[model samples]
Target: MADKVVVFDFGGVLIDWNPDYLYRQLITDDTERRRFLTEVCSLDWITQQDGGQPIAKGTAELVARFPEHESLIRAFYERWHEMIRGVLEEGVALVDKLEAAGVPLFGLTNWSDETFPWAWERFSVLRRFRDVVVSGRVKLAKPDPAIYAEMYSRIQQQVPGVAPQDIVFIDDNVKNTRAASALGWHGVHHTSAGATEVQLRELGLAFA
Candidate 1:
């Protein structure tokens, strides 16, 4: 129960996310939609990408997995980012409280490169925190040990003597939290900002 570093899951825990949202918006044609989802945009594929695969390689392979549907894959990706728009206010409120408290917060997220820019514009919130470890940029995603290791390394390099126990990571995904714990980092399964405040309170971090 040490008070120190906090890692956060950017997508579901802090920002609102739903796969169906993008799928619904990006896919309208019936046959093309079916082929795009099953062959090109499968959750299993996303999971593999989360496991720390190359986005270009993973995407290329996925597109190649269906010889007949490569053109549809191109169109599907072209419209993907427009589906994601903003953050959930409840999450941002807690983050704002933590920022106001001067607690060091870092994001450990598994998201594509495109989604965040739009979200940042909509929420006007990314600059408030430090170290946004996005899978797209880092080429490593969550639930994979590499992302956590890289994040810890970067934090330590930036601010010397900041240990794993000093950081508390919050995310909604169980696998992600568990993986981070295995790496000796403190992580939490985020439910709501109200509840998260209780956990951070113990860590001497501000939460609202």
Candidate 2:
């Protein structure tokens, strides 16, 4: 088995973050909450922030469009910390196991530059990565070919002459993983820690 460089997606793979965590406190009605999340503050809208749009600009535009949900929209960022419950312990354990085995670890995440700092300060596990390529910081997001190319380039900066095939990227979103696979990198669609561990083990990554 070849020595592989491991790249991890932070959100679902390592950190437990969800807008619902914040919405639940703001919007009590399940149906109404679902409607607001899907229609007003949708994932598509949030992805803009994740792709480098300023949080204030995004929020202001959203509030303008949905004047009725002004308070809710404002609270999205003001109360952003509530959205992140904590690190996914199992996933962090994988990082620890890999680190213990001397595996080279890197991070690729589609997170807002404005909000990522909070996570960086809160989650010590995030600091373990040798290098982290943040989408918002780089003005690129996943599922976009450009972002994957950017990640490849960044990895090359650290590991000169490293082929894309020598990298294994783990992402919770299948679309993102598929994008990585298209770039000749081994992509693991992480559903759960146990399942991800199994796949990594098969690829010559040993974790105890």
Instruction: Give the best candidate by lDDT.
Output: 2
How much lDDT does each candidate structure score? 0.71, 0.92
lDDT of 1 by residue, 1-208 (tens): 4447677777776666665566665567767666667756776687565555655676688677776666655544466555455677888888777777666778777876654566667656665667778776677777778888898988887668887777788988878888887877767778787777787786666443
Model 2 TM-score, 2 decimals: 0.95
Over 4 Å off, model 1: 25-40, 47-60, 67-76, 114-116, 202-208
Q: What is the TM-score of each candidate against the true structure?
A: 0.77, 0.95
Pairs in clash, predicted candidate 2: none
Off by over 4 Å in 2: none
Among the numbered candidates, top TM-score falls to 2
- Candidate 2 worst ten-residue window by lDDT: 199-208
